[model samples]
Target: MSDPTTQLTVLFMPESAHGPTNQCIGIGKVLLDRGHKVVFAAERSWEGKLAPLGFVEALVDLAPPDPGATDEAAGQFWIDFINETSPEFRKPTLEQLASFVQPTYQALIDGARYAEPQLKAIIEEHRPDVLVEDNVVAFPALVTSGAPFVRIVSCNPLEIRGPGIAPVFSGYAAADPSGWEPFLAEFDRTHQETWEAFNAWVQEQGAPPLPARDFVHTSEVANLYVFPEELDYTDARPLGATWHRMDSSLRETDAEWEMPDSFAARPEGAALIYLSLGSLGGADIELLQRLIDVLGTTEHRVVVSMGPRADEIRLTANMVGDAIVPQTKIIPQVDLVITHGGNNTTTESLHFGKPMIVLPLFWDQYDNAQRVDETGYGVRLSTYGFTDDELLGAVERLLADTELRARAAATGEAIRSRGGLRVGADVIERVGLDHVRGRG
Candidate 1:
């Protein structure tokens, strides 16, 4: 319990994207409602989103080659690259993946450099008692600011590193003991190159050296995983003492949405499939059209969130495409979700006991898709080399499978029993207050 006499000021710094931004807002709302002062530091454009939440906002300027570029650009680049190589998986060699991620890495380094002074100014001005950071690109700035902070793992469980676990980017399911050696070797080689480059950049920026690891892991008073433990690689590999697995940090909004008139009047027996490719994945017009064409033939009512490219696509009577939709509101009404397997969408679907057909494109989406299949709650489809028949078949199979829905319901119950939002807030308040009191 918090002391009534003391009100802690908390600052949240999340990378400028929907997933990370939403996670921060979920926790920040809890903190604000509990009588503490909450602030958010992100790109200037996000101020509109943050303003409605009533939190004090601080905007940071990311450095050049693109001055004032937001963190969303990194994901946009990945989307553009995927589209350029569409209809076929560009399985870049390890060296090529390293080269591909370099510009994004440099952008992070530059952002951190620019953010250091901005964070220092905020710290000096607000004198926040604790900093809550979405573990994306702000670690260097947090460490240099000398502020006690908590790291939130909004993506995969890459922190639990060891020999038996599969590499995050490989999209491979957890392997048997004998089968993991080769994957481990490749994991080490790939990350070694990445860390060498990142650490070199850190030195150039005059920040403290980041510890070398197979993936980005930071030392913190408490590291919160905003995902169920069931999605983790394997129970055999223990998450060490410092880690805490919390329920999904999805904030429930009071705003309500009704189904589109066309969707509402669809045949009663038809299955409802909510198809979203996330903010980044929806950029591929060709891929979106292909998916729309394939799903249109099924006896399902398809609702697509086309993001920025919604106007470019044509829809049929069986399909409804919108530039944006209240996904949280719609996920519950749908029978099945066809998605890019993003962490936010994956967890939300699990929370509502909805089965999914996961079509992963890049990053941890592949890892999330693998877990969905491994957990028996969904089926995984390859984003590349899949025909209309394959896409239609997977959807038909998932919608018709009774056992999959049962598994999804069981997992959803387990997650809700853990006390979703309260579990996360309790950890944050206890650890954050302790650190402020110098008892951590």
Candidate 2:
């Protein structure tokens, strides 16, 4: 057993995405309060975000880039890569979808190579007891660190795989298991190609080959899932014993934000709808404008968070548009949420007992949207080829459906009943300490 007073140094290697970063913050705070030293190996921009939380931040460039480029160059390379591979530009075919994600898999390879040296330096300097990794990217770096590592699934439970389990990327529910074999076959092929390419790169770097086929595989120590079990497809297919599901890792924020004047001043009995496409999905100006136009015509008062593209759009009298809104503050007041199916947004919306119309853009968003629809608490709309009428109809249905509202409320209560942040921290601390003592 480890000394109770010993302050173990815990390190986190989270992907640069907003959802993963936010989750790191949530878990970091809990561990910090438990008298542990927390450090984050993230991008330079994350320094400001971690500083206020009292975490020691080691800035590293982990962005996936083109071959033979410096980390700084890789940052711009990723921007260009995203521009070229945005889901808005891709077709709905399985081949196109697979092609669209190839760059992401390649980026993980690039990021691992880019981050390995910095991660090694951090490990040598800090001598962390355990490394907690968000199971999206940076697997190569984590494996090379020579420290016990814990995996956290901050998004959809993709790492939990077994027979009869639907493909992680497929938006289909587990109930209809028929006719999915071909898609799963194609998905497996794509996954194998990604794994082979990454393995070859790791070999060239003189790193040991990964034991698993993909980056989403669970860690041997422990894998912490931040989502509730009700939202997962865990019926017949059982996850590994090391896998643990805790409640949502949503951190409470004290930032004060009021509803926009247009929304606040809406006529009595008008429905209020909050629309956010997350940080990445908001870049599609065409989709944003189409959503704005359609929702603006509805009797409901709409508030749109355009993320970085807020300045490019125009808002009408019944609508409000901003670069970013305090969604935590707005979610409880709204009757329904229109989102791009990002996990944070999906779980937050459900936690607040608000119904949603999910327009999944890409990645785990599709799976999350599928879960929402399957649970009878929300509706799903295709981000590609969705007409204004379809968007309006989905929103209207969610808003009017009393049964869906009841289901959402019940689900929210169930999720809240499960210990949230505290439970997640307990698991992390226990696994991390056990690993540290075992190493000794």
Best by TM-score: 2
As a whole number from 0 to 100, the lDDT of residue 340 in candidate 1 is: 89
Question: Which residue pairs does candidate 1 place in steric collision?
Answer: none
Per-model lDDT: 0.72, 0.75
Q: Look at candidate 1 and tell me the lDDT of residue 202.
A: 62
**Residue 341, model 2, lDDT:** 88
Best by lDDT: 2
For candidate 2, give the lDDT of residue 229.
67
Off by over 4 Å in 1: 65-89, 92-96, 176-194, 200-208, 214-217
Clashing pairs in 2: none
Candidate RMSDs in order: 3.3, 3.4
Q: After superposition, how far is residue 59 of candidate 1 from its true place, in Å?
A: 1.3
What digit string (tens of lDDT, one per residue) describes model 1 on residues 1-440? Answer: 75666678888888776888877787788878888888887766575778788789887766534764555775466567656644334463233334444445556656766767777787778877777777555445555556577777787765445545766555676654453555556555655676677777665555567655522436557777777766765475676676777767777643566887777777766888898988767887777788888877776788888866677887766877687788888888888998988888988888888998888876677778888887787888877668788888888788778887787888888887876667667677876687677844
**Where in model 2 is the C-alpha error above 4 Å?**
1-4, 63-83, 87-90, 144-146, 200-212, 260-265, 436-440
